[model samples]
Target: MHAIPVSQSLPETLDPNIFSSPSSPKVGSEPQGHITEQVQTIWNPYKNRYRVLASCILSFANGMNDSAPGALIASLERDYNIAYGTVSIIFVCNALGFIAAAFFISTLSTRIGRAKSLMISEALLMIGYTAIVTTPPFGVVAASFFVTGVGMAMNLAICQVFCANLANNTALVGAYQGAYGIGGIFGPLIATALVSRGSKWSRFYIIELCLAALNFGIAPRTFWKYEQESKSLLPQPASEQQDRERGTVKRNDRTKRQWQSFKTLMSNKPTVLGALFIFAYQGSEVAISGWIISFLVQFRHGDPSKVGFVTSGFWAGITLGRFTLSFLAHRIGERTFVFFVTVGALILELLIWFVPSIPGDSVAVAFSGLLLGPVYPCAVHVFQRLIPRKMQISSLSLIGSVGSSGGAVAPFMTGMLAQHVGTFVLHPICIGLFVCMGISWFLLPKAERRDE
Candidate 1:
């Protein structure tokens, strides 16, 4: 039998399914088969710009929330008359919230859609900030952080999946993560200024509350009907359509599928390694952001007012790196770029550890932030390519949310150790975590070049 010619159409008399085989393309299916190849680029002016903008706004607020703890920790301890170990409960609660969100975010996104999920996240952040601003008991404040963490995790998982799938993903991911760095910069600055000026540490959340309120409106407006728009922009795969048409699917199965996705995510080598890499990366980042000030104040005897600015410096460097150095990741190849930066960060961390002077240590901390900054976006870009596309959202949610628990675990450990050993413990912990990052980075499977 002769092969069917591309120029010829299938006969009207014959059923198209008769020509279809598992190993062969079905008659008249070539154009439809190529639908999966179509993708949305960041340059789409009709809608993606607005979506990206909304994501950035959400990220900026998250940065402010995460970094503020560093600037406010001292004041919190003073006001509550709590020791380092006690003040660190906020990190534990925040991590618990993130871990809890990891379990439900995928389901929430599926059931309610991205827009409503994001709006709910913003609402949670607002509530958390409101609780903090009231300057309630330390336990209540810690619980408030748990609420914020749940909200932040939801936004992070959704935005990351969206940004990672766009064209020019590395650059876009960099820009997205860069927004977080910018927020981190201002978080400490505002918090420090407010505290130094005789205002309460909790007063800083007033700014965060305002930002969350803005995002609450922006998220729904920008992301409303997002799933429909995305389907229109990038048509669904035939497999996905088939899955939908199965009609046997029920709302109850969503939970089953989510658990299966988690299990599948854990079994993938790249996913597991990626999670570990983020675990180390964020662990070090938050440890430095949360503890560097105490180190400076204790070891160098630096003034609390002036030294508090160091956290802002560190975040500024992170912002600069994510924006500027991230361009190099695409050129150098994301995998190679990550190795160089991780090594650079480790060296700088050691310097921060041993350096005797406040000025030198502060500069090292900033440069360390600069080196560590692009690692996240770059790693995320690589993970997107390595993981199967269908699993990307749940995989990234696991990688981001569960992995980000390191931000809490590491800092909580640092706070506890600082109470016993002194703030100097931060440098060694950070250095060790950097080494873990290196190892995890090395273990990650190489991402193959994706077809356009």
Candidate 2:
């Protein structure tokens, strides 16, 4: 086994070989020669910048694919003359698809390279979007969404792992996720504008399909260059040094370590509390976005076109909030920042519920978006800090999958509630979830302060 240097901190330029090669040296207990080779592979400024940019673009694609479907639902329902309850089945299908993919596709990504997995996912998205645009039957539409959900599941699960590998500092994970917020903001806004101008809703899918294609097409060339540059830094492995050069740890040890880390994560009080916080945060976000159009049109008596724009405004606020807070949270503190934002979100939700005019309600909803934006990503950032790096993908996937159940359940409940009571009731429920998030935020264990 060839010994290789492994840092306490993750290297900026991660070689696919480090993760893939069975013969690679164990970290922390490698031989002197292996240590020298690994040290040489440390990320430089330019390489780090490239990885950051690549990860951000991947995140942007994730946001664009995710937000587009929800935003287009209003127009789809109108054109199809479907009941709101029936329209909501799309979300359920999407969520179920996500959950299924979380269990199945993410494991596939680990076996096939992350890059190939991502590329396949984007291609699936293109196919799904094409199906939605070309096919007419409601069942087909739902099936299309399910297919997209698989892609979304793969994208969300893998993108962060990719980013986490790229980032030298664990602290920047939230900021990296913030780029997704930017994509979320623009995607819906652009889709809304297109729909408002009387473009067919199917056009949105076509545009997204093309974008996914473009992203997939460019990935191989760029990522290959990155991989090569990263690999060159490591020392050539000795031909006969199989056992010694492979270092102290075995594959079974790595697997055991990952499982132990996950067990540690599940048992940790702070991690559970943080996951709960994410659950509430995601539930509230989905409730608002999923029900906003119905609320505006059915209860508040706003125009469909105008409501679409209002919904986009809400996403815009979320995007802006994430970008602003990504930098600010590192400066202040995650706990303190979460406290302030949760309070603001609660207040904004109340204002959104009570406000009379569409314009006033729209403005309030936008502000609520801003306040709600930072909570989830920051919670994720905190979780990453608490857990071991090797286990981050599996642990995060497990937690995120659980929290995303809220994304599924909330919309379903909203549909049921609207059927029984009225669409306007979603506001009160959202406000209540925000309150729960705020309380949960306080319950999370505070990270020890480190001089930044």
Candidate 3:
């Protein structure tokens, strides 16, 4: 394929097909008005810059919304008069939302297009946040959690896919995920400050609501009319659209496509291993923060009021690790570095579990987060190269959803066990999960290309 140079100034009327990819433009296509402006708007190099900005916004919001609960769980327990076991059920609801979104989001993306589907997801976030901002009834609050989880799942799936496509290489993708770490660090602090001041915990959600609303306005415009729109805008022969539809049947068509995509994704060796690896990785990672404060307060006898901030330090390490370690992963190679980081994390997990001092455990937790930080972006980077391009988005979506469900399930089970045995189980369970992660990584199909 040869490149077509976009003009600095196209004529008043030019072929609508001029916006097509490097492939030759179709002849006899209708000439459209304002072709120059459209070219600058859609195909300009600066458009990707704008998309990167959108990706950061979504990443920050993702961290803020998901991580805040780590800081707010105590407040939720107190305000709702719930037990640890009961509060853990909320994690199940959230996981349910992520699992449910995984099954249908690819089809949704196919039907409405990714950009519009992303906008709808953002809108769902707004509604969920608004629902939670009030000191509502317990049932209402729980339902709100489910709604917000659905929004987060869809946003994450779309965000990962969009950025993977837009990023030129692994380093760029790492930078994008680094922004997520920064957001995750800030997320808990926002909630902690409000709680520390004796303000209503519900007020914490107000900030999330505002951010969601801002992204709701910006993301659609940033991602408007991606791949599908390109097909629609280019002038296909009049017979082409008809010929394409003639062979397709309407009956059960959408369901078949979703199931087929799911099956294909699950059947791929690299995809299955990648998904399982994340399922273990996020499971272990989230379990640490979700249970760390409780572990400290209940078992380590750390001040109940102060231990929650320890989660901030944990996420801060994650932020710094992604920001700093990503560059190093780029230099040392992602696959090799990931193995070292995971093993290092295993050593740190043991320190947290066996050392048993509040200060020692806290430091170990932060260090573990640092070691674990680069894995997510690095995994996404590998998937981009390893998965067949045709199946990338669907496979990645499944991986993301299953992985996020792991995040929910790990913490939920920890809470259930904590209910019986006590929070002392936190670090040991985390250690075991990380060990499982090590085995999964060993089984993963190696990428054909090495990191640049």
lDDT of each: 0.77, 0.65, 0.70
Instruction: List model 3 lDDT by residue over 257-348, tens digit each.
Output: 54665566668888788778888888887788777888787778887557777887888888788778877887898788888999899898
lDDT of 2 by residue, 255-354 (tens): 6755565566578666577657766777788778778877888878887766776766777788777767656876887778888888888888777778
- Taking all chains together, each candidate's TM-score versus the true structure is 0.88, 0.81, 0.83
Candidate 1 — worst ten consecutive residues by lDDT sum?
1-10
Model 1 lDDT tens row, 68-99: 88988899989999888999888889888877
Stretches off by above 4 angstroms in model 3 are: 1-45, 227-242, 245-261, 450-452
Q: Tell me the deviation in Å of residue 315 in model 1.
A: 0.6
Supply candidate 3's per-residue lDDT for 359. Answer: 87
lDDT of 2 at 106: 40
Cα miss at 180, model 3 (Å)?
1.7
Clashing residue pairs in candidate 1, if any?
A: none
Model 3, CA-based lDDT: 0.70
Q: In TM-score terms, which candidate is top?
A: 1
**Candidate 2 off by > 4 Å:** 1-51, 168-175, 225-262, 388-390, 449-452
Each model's total of backbone clashes: 0, 9, 0
